[model samples]
Target: MKRRTVLRGLAGSAGSIMTIPALAQDRYPERPIRLVVAFSAGGPTDLMARRLAERLGAHLGQSVVVENKTGAAGTIGATEVARARPDGYTLIVAVSSSHAIAATLMRRPTFDPVKDYAGVAVLGTVPMALAVHPSFPARTLQDFLRVAQDAPEGLSYGTSGAGGIAHLSGELFQREARGIKLTPVHYRGASTALQDLLANNIPIVMDTMASIAEPYRGGQVRILATFAEQRSPYLPDLPTAREQGLPGVVSNTYNAVLAPAGTPASVLATLNGAVRTALADPTMQAFMASNLVDPFPDPTPERTMVFIRSELEKWRPVVQATGLSME
Candidate 1:
């Protein structure tokens, strides 16, 4: 009888242990959650974070607060998220520049992109536009390549900054365009680069569609091609580099959500579900459209990790070719 009683106690203990995860998930997000944006407020990353926070709060039954921790090319915010408690309360807005590109560009990486965090979901991707001054003599991507091939040093392209994805895109373009080379000019930001392009000082500028949207729509700048695997839905008429015969010259700035490593699987599932629901909302879709971001077709966490890994591999050689590194 005593042995039976002891066995029953053991069974009960085991069952309770298994129930702990369920109970923890149920009680999760008991308080306000903090979403860290690794960029300045009002930037694209911050905007995405705020938008997700609003919908995530509703889905999780808790308030989601956004905090800006901008610095070190977005490493400051990412480091904080990596070191944060692995309880799902603290999360980060992960971007390709900070999470993937930084790993190869920075002299000393503070965190491991793949190991320090659990990917929640990929929010979306922002494609880069290759724009030029209307009078620069290249109306289409083919025309531009011909001109570049004819006079490799005659054409010059500008990017947002050194060691950025846009800069790397230009590098990749130069390498893949087949005997075509263009001088790279670094600017403070895309807006400044676009300004130069408008002034006819710089013939080409590769920047995000959002950054150059106003100029492109205003007819001040002409976009030759987009650096994406597929054409951007925002501008379907525009041709992608892949379609233009530059197969591997694709560049996209994607944003994702990640929690500190070791976050419970149950909590990760809850967070991923909340993000998926939020992304499907009509309001969210409208916002993303306005911001020039395309919703990721498959946002599962596993896919996000795979995408990040691929991005890291894709940019490593490009960054190395540029021979640039950030302190």
Candidate 2:
């Protein structure tokens, strides 16, 4: 009877001890959380982060502050977040350049995109488009390939920058098409590339749907193909590269939230719940649509990992093929 009593008491003590950690985790975000945007203010990524911070802050009952830590093609902010505490206080607003492409592009990377962080939420995906200035000869994908194959010294396409998703999209497009040879002309930014395209300095430009929306509406540029697995809802009439016969050319960049690896699972669940709730809001839906982002309803860490792995696989071959590396 005495031994049984002792065992029961020990069991009760262990139960209480385990509950303490849960109690602590349940009290997470007692203070404001910092959201790091690895791009400059007024940029697409910063805008998305700020919008999400507002809704997330409201849901968490805590301030979710967005700070721009731009530089090194978004590595500065990413490194800062990767080194922050795993308490879910500091997180990063990651994009394709910072999270997916940088994994294979950077020659001397200080942080590992896969190993150093845990996913909090996936905001949405933005698709890349192949557009030609008004004066370009080809108006359709079939015509564009025919023109490229026979063009003198090959045709050239401008991208926001070398090794960016758009550039990789172009590379993937060329590889999949076999005979379509398109040279890349890297620019300082997408705006500059789009401007050059508008001015007819560049015959072709690979840009995101968000950046191409105005030009596409004004008929200043012809969208030859969208580089997504499916057609964009905003441009449902436009065909994806896959539908146009190049099935291996899906190049999309995602905007997501991530925290330093080892963050408590409870805290991750809280964040994912808040994000999924915000995405389901009608107003939020409108905002994402306006930005040309397709929201992922289920924003879980597992989904984020699957995306990261798949993107790495897709971009790795392109990077190797182009030898696109950064110092």
CA lDDT of each prediction against the hidden true structure: 0.88, 0.87
Cα lDDT tens digits for candidate 2, 127-205: 9999998788887898898998898789899998888888888888889999767889999989999999999999999
Q: Could you give candidate 1's per-residue lDDT for residues 1-327 as a string of tens digits?
A: 999999999999999999987787788978999999999998889888999999999999999999999998899998999999999999998998998788788888888888898988999999987898989788889999888888935677999888887888888888888687777899998878888889999888989988888888889999998988798888888898899888888899989999999998888888999999999999999999998898787888788788878888888999988898887
Worst 10 residues of 2 by lDDT: 305-314
Return the clash pairs for model 1, or none: none
Runs in model 2 deviating more than 4 A are 1-18
Candidate 1: C-alpha lDDT: 0.88
TM-score of 1: 0.94
Task: Count clashes in each candidate, considering only residues at least 3 apart in sequence or on different chains.
Answer: 0, 0
**Which parts of model 1 have CA positions greater than 4 angstroms off?**
1-18, 152-154
